[model samples]
Target: MMAQWHPIAPGEPLRAGDQGPRIAQLRKLLQMFGDYNGHPGPVTANNNNPERFDAGLQLAVESYQRRHGMAVTGVADKATLKELERPPVDLARQLEVNAKRWDKLPDKPGKRYILVNVPDFRLHLIEQHRVVLSMKTVVGKSSKRTPDMTSKVVSVVFNPTWTVPRSILLTDLLPKARNNPEAMHRRGYRVVKYGTNTTTPISDKSIQSAARGKATLRQISGPGNTLGRVKFIVPNKQAIFLHDTQAQSLFEHHHRAFSHGCIRLQQPEELAYALLGPQGWDRTRVAQATTGDESITIKVANPPKLFIAYFTAWVDGLGKVHFRPDIYHRDN
Candidate 1:
C-alpha cells in the first residue's frame, strides 16, 4: 500500500491552540537552525497562521536570508524554499574547498585591516575580534584574472593618476588610438611616439596610423579614468589594490567580479575610516595624506589582521551549514 497525504487535521477554522502535524514540522525546521524561540506569542491570522508558519518560523527564515545577502521578507516563498532545500552534500563540498583555500593564508596581526574575497565578491573590515563592516565588491574578470594575495595598505590616493598597463595598452587602447588620437587625449590619455632608436611625443594622427599597423603604444591618465576618484595602495607583487570604479552599476548585481586585476570596493570611504580609526586619523587627515604631490605612506599604530579567504560552505554561529554559489568555479 502507498502512503497517503493528509491535510494535517486542524480543520478550516484552525486556531492558535491547535497543534497540527504541519506546525510540528515547522518547529522542527526552526530548531535545526537554533531558532525555536522566534514563535513569540500565540499563532494567529494577524501574524500569518502562526500555528503553521508562526513568528518564530518567520524570524528563522529572515536570519537565513540576511546571512545569504537575500531579501529578508520572513516568508518562505519560492526562492527561499529553493535555498532551504539545497542539497547538503553540495554545501559540504563547497565548505571543504574553501577551508582548504583558507589554510593557505598568512597569519599577521595589525591594529586593523581590510580583507576581500574575490570569488565570493565581498569585503570585510576586521578590527580586533569583530568584523567592523562588510560590503559587496566586484573583482576582476576571468580574462584579467584578479589574483588572491595579501599586502599592507601604504597609502590612499585621491584624484589619482592611472598608469595604463601594457596589456590593456596593446590590446584595448592601441586599437582606438589608431582610429582617433584626439579621442585618447580628450579622455585624458597622454600619447607618445617610439622610433627604432628613441621615443618622443607624438600626434594623435600618428598614433592612430601606428596602432593601425600593430605598433606598441600606451596612454596615461585623465577624466574618463578607469580608477575613479581614489585608490588604496597596498604594496604587493600583483599590483592590486582597492580602487573606485566608474562602473558603479555593477554593484547592484549579486555577483560582481568584473575588474582587470584589482578589487573595486562598494564603500571605499567607510573602509578608509575603519582602517585609519585606530591611528587617530580622521577623514580630513586621510584625504590630505592622499592629495599631496607625492605618494605618502601612513603606517598604522597597530595594523589590523586581514583574511582574504574564499569559503562557499561553512557552519554558521548556530551550527547550520550555509552554502553559496561557486561563482569562480574554484572548486571544479
Candidate 2:
C-alpha cells in the first residue's frame, strides 16, 4: 500500500472538480486512512472523469484534516499533503519510541491526574482513566521544549505577575526595549533594579541597565498580562509552569509551540474550577480572583499528579491511530 499510494505532487492542491493522477492519488491516500468512504473502485481509462475530485472526496479530505488537528479546508493543501507523505516505516518507528515512553508510567497512575502530552499540544484531566476535561495547550518552541518530567500541581495562582524569565529578557525583549522604553510600559512591565522592590522609570538608561543584566522587569497583573489570569504551579527545579495565556489565537494553531517553556491553557477558568473545587473554591471565586489588583495563590490539599510526556503517536477515543508532526524532533 505504501508504494501503491504516494503524496500528491506538491503544487496546486487537488480541489473540487480537479481531475488527473493527483486526484486519484489523493483519493487513494484518503482511502488508506479510511477517510474516503465513497467510490472504492479504481479509476480506469474507460470511465469518464472517474478521477475527478467530487463532493465525496472533499468531505473525506475535511474529515481527515479535522481528525489530525489541521485546517479543515477540504482540499489537498501542502500541510495535509506533507503529513500524508510521512513514510509508513517512520510512523512505525515513532510508535515504537512512544511505546517505550508509555511504559514508564505505572499501570495505575491514579484516579485523578493531569497528562500533558507535549507533542500532541493537549492536556487531559484523566479521572478513573476517563478524560474528565480536555483543552488545547501551547507549549515551548523546539529550541526551548517543555520539559518531560512528572510532578504534582500544588497550587493555582490567579492574577499572577510575570517575573520575566531571564532567557526571554535577554534574547527576546531587552535590545528592543533598550531603545524604546515604551515597549516595556505598553506591556505593563516595571523596571526594577535587580533583586529589589525599587521601581525605575521607563528610561533608556534603565532599559540599558536591564539589558546589561543590572536590572529586571516584572509585568503587572492586569487585563493584558502575559500569564492571562491564572497559572498552575508545579514544584520543579526547572521552574516550569502551566499557565493561562492572553494570546487566545495561539490555541487555534495546529502546531502550538510558541511559548518560551511554559504550558499555556485555553480554558484556564474551567481548569481552575476543577483543580480548586476540592479546596472550597468554586467558579465564581475563581472568576473573581482573575480580576482586581491583588494576586492570589491557593494551595491544593489533594494536588493532582502531573505527567508531562512527549508522545508523537497515540490512539484516539475512536480507536483510530493519530500522529503528530515530530515538533520537538525527539523521534529523530
Candidate 2 residue pairs that clash: none
Write candidate 2's Cα lDDT for 1-332 as tens digits: 66665666766767888888788878878888788888435745533354888777888899888767677899888778878887767777888988898899878888899999997789999988899999999999988889998999998899988877778888877776776778679878888887787886668777778877888788888888999899899999888999998899888787899988889999989988998888788898888898886889899888899999988887778887777777877787
Compose the digit string of candidate 1's lDDT tens values, residues 1-332: 01221223222322234445656654555465455565567755665444465556667767766655566677655565556554445555667887787678656545466777776688887667467899888888877777766666766565566655667776887777667767666666654344432232447565665555534443333335677656777777777778777788999887676788788888876676666666787888766654433534445444454455566665655576556666667778
Give me the runs in candidate 2 sitting further than 4 Å from their true place.
Answer: 1-11, 39-50, 182-186, 192-215
Q: In candidate 2, what residue range of length 10 has the lowest lDDT sum?
A: 39-48
- Whole-structure CA lDDT of model 2: 0.84
Note the Cα lDDT for every prediction shown: 0.63, 0.84
Q: Could you estimate the TM-score for every candidate?
A: 0.72, 0.85
Q: Report backbone clashes per prediction.
A: 12, 0
